[model samples]
Target chain A: MIRRGLLFVIIVAALALAPPATAERLIVSLSTHRVLINSNFTGTELVLFGAIELADPDILDRRGYDVVVTVRGPQRNFITRRKAQVLGIWINAESREFVEVPAYLAVSSNRPFAEIAETEFLRRSRIGIDYNILTQRIGTDIADVVPQDPFRVGFVRVMRAEGMFSETPNGVTFLSSTHFRTTVPIPGSAPTGTYEVETLLIANGALVTRETTAVEVVKQGFEALVAQAARDQRLAYGLLTALLALLTGLFASLVFRRD
Target chain B: MRRLERRRPFGPERAHVSIYLPIAELPVNLFVILGLGIAVGFISGMFGVGGGFLMTPLLILTGVPPAVAVASVPSNMAANSMSGTISYWRKRLVDIALGLVLLSGGVVGTAAGVWVFGVLRRAGQLDLAVSLSYVVLLGIVGSLMLTESVRAILRAQRGEPPVVRRPGTHAWFHGLPLKLRFRQSRIYVSAMPVTAIGFAVGFLGALIGVGGGFMLIPALIYLMRVPTTVAIGTSLLLVLVTNLIATVLHAVENRTVDAVLAFTLMIGGVVGAQFGARAGQAMRAEQLRLLLALLVLAVGVRVGVDLITRPADPFSVVATETFQ
Candidate 1:
């Protein structure tokens, strides 16, 4: 009887400490979970539809809230080489290496991110393409304190040029006070990895609850097998390739004799 | 009542199929890859070339990674050339002795070339070196082929007797030591010169990683004075051996060969060769030579432009296979 009484009291206290049930504000659903790449795969666009639940009646009376959605690809190490003129020819001079950086990144906000959040908040949340970075190790961390922003800036610029990093200030559209949606575009050159989807809720020029989800991008069919073989069976893959070249040539020659 | 399903504008979900490239790390349309194979294969059969120079750049243009393109192209070329070699062999056109001699030199040349490639690569000057050599080699080869073929064509047009460099015709060549007889080619030349020629071609082949057939044919004809038919067939035979060895090296050492890509390209290529060989049969030998010369010149011009042009970005990233 004493144990049951203690459990009942703990439940009551937990309920009292929790946020108001009516304060439930974020509800999200992704159009899909997996991106399949086949022969016709050019690229893909994903629709993220979500609704904002509110307890305050006045909020519904005015504009709902600002929404920011950012999608990031898997992290990996990359090396960037800068070229300088050497003997009247361009050659790689300085090299910077970075670790734990996203292979691809896309950021979309309902308004200019600067207008919605302060620089500190934006940096913390990584709401912009250039701001929300998870930099771990850098190859050119000279002095361990000297500014690395220059190389970082170059990295972003290079990625942007390659269509691997993109940002749109007004990409998100609000259909109503309670519903908002956005479209995330994936380029054909996007690497295969797990992609992170982040949705942030903002109210009264302040931070609100943020929800993060994940999606996967993978290669299927013959292409996947090929890549897998290269990674797992490199020698075999090479041998097979050479053998195929020989066989195909032999076949063509034999099949096409005129005399 | 069922509601109508609205179609989204663009998405991978709508794609019916895509052929994924393993080493290239991308998916391509099946038809596109097949079509490319066929086109390159057709050219290979018609000219008795390995088609590596053509296919490698084409793959790069279509977004295959440069390392993968370079490593994988030779294998594909080997396959196409093998078929052409077989056809030529059946016709008794291949000078087996001459091809073997050249191949022996090619083996040594390839080893030396690989060492050079490694040294240049370590210094980060490989690209520049390769490009420079390509520009020079193509320029010389292109002009020589063009001039020689034009002369032959003009003589044919005038109904004049064609110049044939027969056995023992070049006294200097006949005077060389270690003379060997190639019955098929009907020539007696020193093994030293033939091997030397083979070595030069082989070394160049290893460095470039393209088939040696195109470059080798002209040398066999003009330098050692091998007949055109035997030259083409022997060149293919030499390429077959050299390329096979190169493929094994790249696969084992560099690990850059993509079997999927090689096979995808070869499928269309093998089928297309049948038609191309037939087409080549209809043309005169002089016309064929002239056409081949022009094609060689075109490649030279294209590479020459790339060397001098101002690049949009002076910087480029070289992704190491450390992660791979």
Candidate 2:
């Protein structure tokens, strides 16, 4: 038993040393992990803080640190339309469908995202709002999705107008050399789901390490019951709504009757 | 301690209660929804219309998703029509024989329309089809009503004697086969035509977010020669039933009906309908008809303009909800 335990510890040590870059060097957490969306809920803010796990003497010389924090809500598919003037009337001429795009997305970085990482890296990791959509699930193949289209642009524009997708440069502030913080405002229209808070640590214009944590947005109290009933017991809920209307009408007629 | 308090993860609490809508996936001020309901209810009561066409657009403008708005309006409509039908029934103006026949057809048509609605929705053709149909139906009906009401006002000014007709007789649609006598309507006509009319109205009403009252009343008076009082009551009864079907379909099939949203609206609607009925009594029938015609035309024009003109954002996004 002792020999086996020693071998397990040695294996863990070997794995830990094999790729220091693959291990999460930054510790990230949110002040509030669960957001209860009650009837009184309007909007709320998430305070995310993180710190470097390891201290290095040449941290300043190692091309400094860049933090990119993103809070992504549930995934959903969206069909976007692009209008073109036909016979002097603009209609939905061309359309594209995108799948697996976060219903809500917010990004905050220590500096401009362009300054932190190349466009290709940001696009691959979906680090920014511009590249965080999967288009062409319908009416076109996945291979044709690249080279973003006007429909994709429209989706971002609409979400931004609704305050669902947002980016604020200089949103992250470093309290100290190794500690960083950000504030992501949860909009009133944010869908109830498990939101992912991701903190990317970049050095020398490359991603060095990252950390992620989950924050659940859920309906509570009466709100929870109603939402659940509408989704789970839909047929019964519908019948009840109809019955309530019939009863209200019958009750009102008797109460207000006059001869 | 002060610093600790300041570092709290969430912000200070809001004083007003904001209702969280499940299907719409948004939180809005409680009073705002109630007030919207009252406004639409007043319009419905004043004009003798279902008001879904007006209410659905207003809800969409207020940031409720189109699908949710289309689904939830029928709930309030059911309540309004039920109450209206009750008053008419008490007055002994309802023709149960005629109402029941039309309603049988309405039930079948609404069921089929909902199935078509589901199919069209999955194919992403619902919005375009609905918009096109609204422009066509509202434009044609509004213009025809406007002209007819205008002529009535003119004929009245000229002091022309009112047209009189004997009851228990049929004029239009009398030649068709499958003839049946509607004792209350005092007509002998084919069941095929009546059922066809009922089917068309119910199908269109479900496809669009309407209760079919505005269109159905006129058809009953002009085409079927139903007495105005009886037509009103019958129309309300039909509206109540069809609206229920549409609401249930939207709730169960689409999962877009938000109960909380509908409840808040109902609170305002039931009360506002009473006030509207009283106010409507103060106005002349001619004035009311003219006003309603103008309103209908205006709505048609607004929708038509959206189709004809260039949209600000040429592209629109409809998020297909993934339950997971």
Candidate 3:
């Protein structure tokens, strides 16, 4: 009777932490284009625009879930727009090749698609600079870019969704979704940095989510760095050599003293 | 965390871990150190040599730094030498005057040797020179000693008395001006040879980081024609004085002495010496010579092989501008 009671308690705890039976599906997509502006603009400017759709539309504004878009390069920042109108541009403190812009929308609204699109929807975010005047900006050169084969940009969706398996009696497995797309920049003699693509999700023509991802640029090869360090610390090498010599002598003295 | 709780305080963490302690806390490892001291001490008592040639290397192998190993050698020798010399002195075996003269010459030679050492260090050639010299000198000496001892052994086995013939080289000593009498050696010789030998041994001792006892004992016995017993006693006396001086010099210049390590070895040496002395009493002089010769030869061959093999890297390379 006591053993049965203990087993029942364990089973009850496991069932309480188990994930919900239904899973929410999310879809994400990205697009890219070069906006050719006047010759006076010396840099590349990036703008991220995208849409997201959720099958279970009511779960959009869950407290623990977030959607973010990022743009990255050697020196890049973010500019956001709300209601199809420009909001403000902010200096990107964490400027690498990628910068992230994030947006969140609550799920409780029940409105028509046309009404949602007309009601001051978010639009027109710019990453690097204004698209109309691009050439005057100090951007990366064409020849000095890192290979894009290993570089990547992507989005990940983390949900509070959970699940249970019999083998893991005390643990619950959570559900997550990810989507990514990246393009390699042409290598040229330009200042090196990260370049990226960013996107926002639109559900029923209303802004619902955003995400950021990147491609990297680098300068020197790996082996070159090691060779440079060796050249710089020659004295340390010499000292190591001398210590070895002394060790050899001592070993010799020990072995051959009885000649 | 559970394993950490099982560790005991003041226990051997590893076979050769270095332990640091204030002087007051030294007694923890004193027993093992005392044992090493006794072993080397007994060797000193028996052979009347400082045993520094062996001690310095052993200390280094036991994880003491080279500079500290070299510097601590003299102090260790002094302790062993003092104990051995006292016993010999009690037997009325030491020649005080002869030992004093050798000590005086050793002091002067050591100064010169230290200067040469400094110059070689600056030139970045000291490591190579010292190692090569150790191999050359010890190999030759050890081989000669071994051969002589072997011959003596063979003669004894054949039940023949060993022959001793005086070398016909008295002409070399005739012209030297200052003549001195050494009652123990029973010779009236010019001070030049004694002084020269002292200087040579002193230089070698400094360079090799030994107490010069091995060199001094052999030179006294074979060249000066001192009796074996007298040579042993006088050698110990000279070593005691010379090593004391060297220890002081090393302390002043390099501050390389590690008192803890020295004390540990000395502890072992002292206990070992008592047993070694007892063992020595049972052995014949020929047997002792044979053993010493074999030991030295083994050391020499080891050193020589290293020197002849591929060139080795140096321990330190301080950059300096060369005019040329």
Candidate 4:
């Protein structure tokens, strides 16, 4: 009995002193392609699809986090040239947290090619390409990168693609790729740690390859502690109130009658 | 000590007032409630029906608690029925004895209905039952009315007489004992049928949140063979009494009635009742019955369809928790 008690004490001490294990990371692949064009090519547009996967085994243990993707490229030229154009930007994933299971990326487009591009190009092509090209290309390349910071994990890349060439007064005829990249900063309130990161190369609106690296985010002061409490509290209250009011009103109406 | 005093914002003395006026102090959604009242009142007056059947369902659909919807409907119906009943009485059309007898049964039926409502609600079957009943009853009634009305119109256009003769009198009614004299109806009939009808109307009114005017008027005219003029007046009188009782019951039991909501609906109903009474004067008895029957059938079908297609969602959100 004495030996067992001593062993328990040692185990508790070790657990208290040891650093918390890092949460598993998730990698999402997003892809976009432009296939249709109208005369003037200015209206020609691209579509995007995204997919998500667990990067580390431990990712399944951690709470899910939202994913946001922004694709930025020359908007004006693409619209006028009847060329595949990346307009303002596309955020395939909005505010959604997912577990370790694979999730299909929401696929969408700005507008139909016929509607946006010049009428002539639209008449030429009837077939539309799959929207998942970009997600597949980038997601596959970045799957290996582990997040060094348990709280922070993300990647961005610039991709260029060229294909069946066509020209217009506004731009060159060669099907060209649009490139952009972003690095998201984990706020101080985020979990303290380092995270694995990955880089993706995309061509013809598809993720072609990837590069992996480590990202570090150091812990900071009191502000982080306060910020986290505020966020969690606010989310909890908002969801609770809206759901409650809607339900109570419905049930009460059904159950009681004056007569 | 000062800090402790500051922390306790409300003193113990203030607690009772807070409980009594909990909802009273809260901001009311007056516009939405008033709009619903006006629409329901207009329909009720124009159609010469209490409109509770439609109003109660409409209130629920718009997110009012079911208890509140049921509780408030009778009060609203009372206001409208009062105005209409008074006008009919002035015109010397009311059959007071027949109306009183029906009302007696209606009151008892209403009490029983309310009790059953409680039971079904606890068992979680109320919504499905109500919806199914609405659809089935309305579909049958509406089709029959529509068919009868169309036939009447066609016959009239072809220069046929308005009244159709029956071969036999109401012999079964004569056999019933405990006869009562209804001066306005100018007949002596057993009090049993009148009381039974009253009870049925009362119970249905409480369960379905209606005044039972539509049902009562038809029963008086067809089942009792009362004249059309007396039937209308008697039905309206019965509606007034039954609705008054329902309103009182709701107030005492559930405390669900929103006085402000009831007031708003009453205003609309009052105005609509005047116009409705005027229009009713011009319509033939058969025409009016046909129209009312069609309305009932329509409402019934709607309720029934809702039950069959998608029973009420059992898991509903309530008071910061989800309950089934």
Candidate 5:
């Protein structure tokens, strides 16, 4: 009985000390791959269901896991301006141009990002809205700044107010030992584009595996046709609009005849 | 602190009644916009003006982008003035020959104005320019009209006949060359002054989204010595044509006009204009002028206060461009 106990202890220690034979793999599926923005679109929520497949069942029975889901919309450039009192009137004084930044960015996790991992690790991985690099052009220089940078903070604050940039703790919920789910919000003003949804699986404060999926937001129906016409056939569109206004005026004159 | 509250979806509370403007890319309350249109239309119809100066500022206040508000007002002006132009034409009050001469100058000025508008927009100074122009123009015109109308009322109370126009008197521009006779206006004037006046009206109309009726009518009567009826008719015709041109130019150049929004405003405008015309006939002209002057001054003062005061937030943001 003593020899058997020793052998069990050694085996358990070996298993614990050795590197994971196979990393945990992530499989995720979104509720919908396409979000259609019609005249009635007033923002929506997308459900993401994920499962963790363990390669070695005996690796860890504690089932302590963490998840951070990030949804990033198409990238675009932005300009942020600071107003100053000029000649006794407020006007835009200094401006910063942010290049190639996500127009919509939402980072959600099961718990606070700081509780899940070290700040350096989080920054390195770009795991939160604050960690994501927001490139800016300042005079002749083009680079991202520290998290506390004023321009960066202003840009993020404006975007957050517009509901385009957000961070939600406890957004991810674990359904079981191996299953998890989250609801990603798409604001009403969310730009129409291919949004990339990235799910990271962390175990013991280290990233184990990740998976990526995509969702498309598109302008559909009459709204789409109008925007398309305005872009593709600008002259015809303009002339038509002018003609419509003129006809409406003439029609009103005929209907409300005076003398 | 880590857990942030999400924005409430423009749901439940604003559902059903909100309409999505494809170009503006925002949802606005339908009834509110319609009511605004009707209100502005009523004032325009009663005053025999295009009402764009009021409409553009109001649209901006209601959260439409300045570009969209400025670009869209021309179409509404064109529509509003067309009905008035038709009635004036039927009465033979319009001086077509003079109108054509003015239009020749107006087209050039409008083209220049649209170009300047584009440049200002790129520089992000359009809002300031719009506000500053409104304050200066409205302040001067409003004060002038207020004094003139008040003087006329006082003269009537003193039992004095209204001052008569002295035809022999001529302004400095009258001595210029290129003299033309306007049979409808019953005046012989230099085409130079007429064209210059048209250019000014067109520039103001395109840049500030106003019909220039208030300035044009007064200039015609006081400067050109045209009959009051003919001046009103001619000015309405000019506003119609110039606004039509401005609308097309803005749409083609900026692509900022929102058709859905314009249509809503137009429907409300036409209906309210009919009633406003009736109300206008009931009021005396001097009293109406005084009221309009006060309204103009009020708007000017409101915009001026906004400029001088500190804004709620010191930072503003704009997307550089759309990806597609």
Candidate 6:
């Protein structure tokens, strides 16, 4: 009887704290917020469930509703080099540096991004990867170029090939009039960092509401300790590694001694 | 619902035993690495060689990045040489004085090689440098060994007596200044020549992840006129010390040494080497040398082909701070 009373009080409190119904509000939840990368870690998928809290309960206008989910991993600089044949041998020649781009990016939407919003709005809001600005350093100039630029195209293509960047139309599926979910794939080579997951609610070619959540990918256990030691105490780590090599060698010799 | 799981060569279900390499930051099949270690160990034991030259290339073929593969080799070398060094030391064949002089020079050479490795990596020419070096070194050594073995075989078939070299022949290098007496080797040689040899061996070891035994043994025997037993023991000692230092340098400078990977390879290699050693004793020395030569040539040719051929994709992408 006391447990039932407490549950009722929590529901009343949630209703009391909720915003007054004025515009559509987004409620999102991730299957997991922490991804531990340890031994035996291959890759993993995360599910994101979201629901639209509407002002009116009776009217169902799901036909006009759209959802787009963007998951972006930590940003890092990368260099895309194009090889040229120099003296009958291929070597890296021309290079372009992409400054502060998402290391991993996945864009998922209920339908194609173009149909959900105007081109101008999409670019302004950074709804899609192409629409997102990626600055590059070309010799002296540092600015974003056209989406179709060769270097930009090549960078995206290479990242996509490595399973670091992806885009899937109709990735988000609506379970009911107001509920939807999508899957986010974290590849084996994914860098450990805080990943931001943004969910956008689009209605009539304009975003009505949006929500952002965070997921942390971390190296745990022995993997974490080793990486940490290598980075932080490098000299000591080096010495220890050498010592370990000596010990392992000596141990093997002792174990397999013929005399 | 749209399925977003991209097509991978092996799904999670397909890979039952996988281990994450802390430095490489990738999960690799444990069994595959172990099996490779065993195969290389077997070959190394049968041939009485370090096997690092074979191990590094095989690791690269198994999808390990070249930098990691190169750096991780030193630790494995250190382990592989330890047993031989210990055994040789017990027999009192090692020239400790000579080994120390070589090590002094080796340290400097290793430092220089590590710096060169960093520079080449930054220039995006490390892979090219590595491949080119392998082609040149392996090709020369392989052909030399092959011809020597073939000649020996022909001589035996003709029922000819083996030519034996007279001991105590002084070389031009022996007249140089700063001569040092190595009691075990029973020779007083100029420190400069000995140090120079060590420098070359150490430099190659650091750059290409090899023990340089093939070069050292021949140089010691032919150039320095050291006795075969002493040369072998001293060479073993040099390989052990240089590799230990190389591992330290690689870890400190390039930060490319993966201890986990090294340990895994060592585990398999040590066990496999024992069986291979037994099998090697049953085979004729000339036949064994020929087989090793062919294996070396094959690997060299394979690397050379990759260098000459045009890559399918002209564009490559790397993080600004990718592994060296």
Best by lDDT: 5
| Residue A209 lDDT, candidate 4, scale 0-100 | 34
CAPRI-style class, candidate 6: acceptable
Alpha-carbon lDDT of model 5: 0.82
DockQ values of all predictions = 0.38, 0.44, 0.01, 0.01, 0.45, 0.41
Question: B-chain TM-score, every candidate?
Answer: 0.89, 0.90, 0.83, 0.82, 0.93, 0.89
Each candidate's number of clashing pairs is 13, 1, 86, 58, 0, 0
lDDT for each residue of candidate 3 in A1-259, tens digit (9 for 90 to 100):
9999999998888876663333333343333343222111122323232333445555555423323333333332211111111122111111112222111111111222233344234224321111111111114532212212111110001100000000111111113323322222221211233544444334455444554555443324322232232234333422332233233323322432322
Checking candidate 2 for backbone clashes, the offending pairs are: B168-B186
For every model in order, the TM-score on chain A comes to: 0.86, 0.81, 0.26, 0.19, 0.88, 0.88
lDDT for residue A245 in candidate 5, whole number 0-100: 75
Tens-place lDDT per residue, model 2, B1-324, is 000000111222432656777666677777767888888788778877777777766676666766677778888888888888888888888888788788888888887777777787776666666667777877887888898778778877899854434456656567889888887777677887788777876787677777788788888887888877788888888889888888888778888788778878877777777777788889867667777788878877777787777676666777776322
lDDT of 5 by residue, B1-324 (tens): 000112233442565677666776666667767887889888878888888888988877666667777778888888888888888899999999999998888888787788788887777677678888989988988898899889888988999987636689978987899999999999999998899889988888888777788788778877899987898889889998888888888878888778878888888887777788889889987788898899889888888888888876666777756413
Q: Which ranges of candidate 6 are over 4 A from the true structure? A: A1-22, B1-14, B163-183, B186-188, B225-229, B322-324
**Model number 1 iRMSD:** 5.6
Candidate 1 deviant stretches above 4 angstroms: A1-25, A55-64, A82-94, A134-154, B1-18, B108-130, B166-180, B190-193, B321-323
True contacts kept of 3: 0.00
Instruction: Name the 10 consecutive residues with the lowest summed lDDT in model 1 chain A.
Output: A139-148
Q: What's the C-alpha lDDT at position A170 in model 6? A: 88
Fnat, one value per model: 0.59, 0.69, 0.00, 0.00, 0.59, 0.67
> Which window of 10 residues has the lowest lDDT sum in candidate 2 chain B?
B1-10
TM-score of chain B alone in model 3: 0.83
Which DockQ-derived CAPRI band holds candidate 2?
acceptable
- Candidate 3 lDDT tens digits, B1-324: 000000111233331332332111111233444555666666765666777766655544443434445656666776666666766777888998888788778888876666665565444444445655666777777777788888989999999997433544465664689998888767667788888888877777666577778888788877777777788888877776666666555544444444445545555554455567677879987788888877777766765554444322211111121000
The DockQ of predicted model 1 stands at 0.38
Flag the better candidate by lDDT, 1 or 4.
1
lDDT score of residue B104 within candidate 5: 84
Write model 6 residue lDDT over A143-217, tens digit each, in one string: 999999988887888788878889999899999979999999998778888999999888888777889999999
Runs in model 3 with CA error above 4 Å?
A1-259, B1-13, B16-18, B21-39, B163-171, B309-324
lDDT of 6 by residue, B92-141 (tens): 98899989998888888888888898888777677778888888998998
